[model samples]
Target: MKYHFFQSKYWVIVWSIALFFFACRDPKQNAKENVKEGELKEPQEENAHTTVIKTIPGGVDTPAGMVWIPGAMFDQGAVAQDQMAMGHEKPSFQVAVDGFFMDETEVTNAKFEKFVKETGYLTVAEREIDWEEMKKQLPEGTPKPHDSILQPGSLTFKKSKSSVPNLYDFSQWWQWTIGASWKHPAGPNSSIKGKENHPVVHIAYEDALAYCEWAGRRLPTEAEWELAARGNRKDKIFFWGDDQDLLGNQANTWEGEFPVMNTQQDGFERRAPVKSYPPNDFGLYDMAGNVWEWTGDWYNTNYYNEVSSKKQLLKNPKGAAKPFNERDRYAKEKVMKGGSFLCSESYCASYRVSARMATSLDSSLEHLGFRTVASVDMVKAEKN
Candidate 1:
């Protein structure tokens, strides 16, 4: 009887070891099976109502400057004679895009402050200038140890004298001020303490990059930027269709006499609150005004021509390998779309949807800000 019991125990031990080996060999399979079972029990929920007629919650405070643009295609370039005269916005093309979300407004001072406070990140303009790197670009006799060049600085347009003519010239308004950064917008004395609602200026591309990375999103590409701004219409002049001034309402931009006297007819002399105006047909706010937003594409004047020639629908098209002119030297400079609150007929007329401009990657201006975009994941129902 004792011998028989011993043999049975030995068999039991062997079985246990075999089971352990089998389990170890197929751990991944077991995990997959468990996942499948979970998935079967709880299927992913979809927003059954495909049409986004109503704005959803969590949509309101998606970082200031971001417009929630429902993804759809529109004419990508200029359709009118005025836009054609702008040089680069020619040969309009039908662009169909997948639905996606975009920021309703330009990024604001308050929103950027939250990003900086959380990450303790320093903007590129805040960092010290590398004299050696700058010297390499200049001629041999170029002044070294120059106060202006060596100083850590950023772009800040000095207020031109009221008497000065052509105050609208960008040069008059833009000044490279030492210690001028997002933190110290007007240099050392300025602080963002109470100006949180204002648009954060003096941000270089690197600064925007850092903020976007922290936020788990990215700057929109040029094609994506234009598409979102155009809404669901053909290449109309502005985001709100062909008429620049609709219903006798001035959406944005400076009024009155250029820099000397901003009439503030549009209710703002500088950057206004995001969503200060009504949204476009696609629920995008401030597509034509407020602040110029940056795009990922490198600026090339002939890029639109190339896209037009293709006659094929280009999905997420990025612009030229090299920049077109001296306007963009840093290669740091990328395309900026839409115009700003400072835009006026007498001065910069970049409010048009097809309008484009470029800014240095390391440069930032009071009128410069940005918005965010994401790829559309679903087909949206058409609006009535």
Candidate 2:
């Protein structure tokens, strides 16, 4: 009974906004930490080395559109290691990831447009979602939603006149507007004409995968994502560190009140262009805020326990088998690392490095976007 309401009510809210402050998703395919099928492409020959010893230094060839993330050993979780940290991120353990190339900035509209123009690839947001596809996540014998409700649209954040709206009911902030895609960010009339440099939004996991495939890249694993994010500064509160006001412009996060009002204290009501904020130590941009980055791990609250149990220096640690969101068992969700533009310190301070959010693979949003990474082996193969 509770699960049904979670889907019926929350689904309507999150599905329209990709997420309402990082909420529900499909449990099976949308496992919070792990990505569903078709997210990874097969590695071809010339992919000889997947992990390189830290002792070995530079000498490898560099790739276009990406920067090399030097291999390192570090603790990959909440730096403060305090009560405020989410349980799913507790018991920080030592994780070693080999050097790999990562995008200097999030995939931008102009870049994704080039991919679409060359491949004529249409994103999931550009197509209607069939009820049959949705029923698979619901209980048996569930009735389909209205056709209009299934139109090609992504979730978007909407503020209400009531400054103090119902926080419990996110419907006040989330709306399933039609024609909300990478091209039409806010709605049918919105355009990315001048915002081409901004990070592309309204991208599903698979949609990101499609862009990666065409570009000969892949999404970063949880370990890779964290390693790259920390920029070798392990166990720090954020990529920048413990100080919230570090640099006086720590990434791009909400300033004033959340949900009801965003004073744009950071000079951004929504997403600022990629690299708008200062880069991390490794010269990586937007590692903390800007938009929640998709990671290649299944959502598991106990995933840390699984890693801690390993007890040994883990290598390329993958996420658990499937996601189990105790709050909404029916929602399949994937891990969304690095919070979004909507994240406010007062409400959802998911911008912290260890912070984790979840949403369904089928969902899209105005604030959710992803970056890409190349496996050591794949890069080797490409060079060969």
For every candidate in turn, the CA RMSD to the true structure comes to 21.8, 6.0
In candidate 1 the C-alpha lDDT for residue 114 amounts to 88
lDDT (Cα atoms) of all candidates against the true structure: 0.58, 0.71
Model 1, span 22-126: residue lDDT tens: 000010110111112110111112232323322334323333434455555455777765632365667765554444567666777888988988988877666
Report the number of the highest-lDDT candidate: 2
Instruction: Name the best candidate (by TM-score).
Output: 2
TM-score of each: 0.74, 0.84
Across 110-221, the per-residue lDDT of candidate 2 in tens digits comes to: 9999999999988878875656655655446655555656677777888766665445565567777878899999999999999999999998877887888888898888
Backbone clashes in each candidate structure, one number apiece?
15, 24
Stretches of candidate 1 exceeding 4 Å from the true structure: 1-68, 81-85, 162-169, 246-250, 326-332, 376-384
Query: By TM-score, how accurate is candidate 2?
Result: 0.84
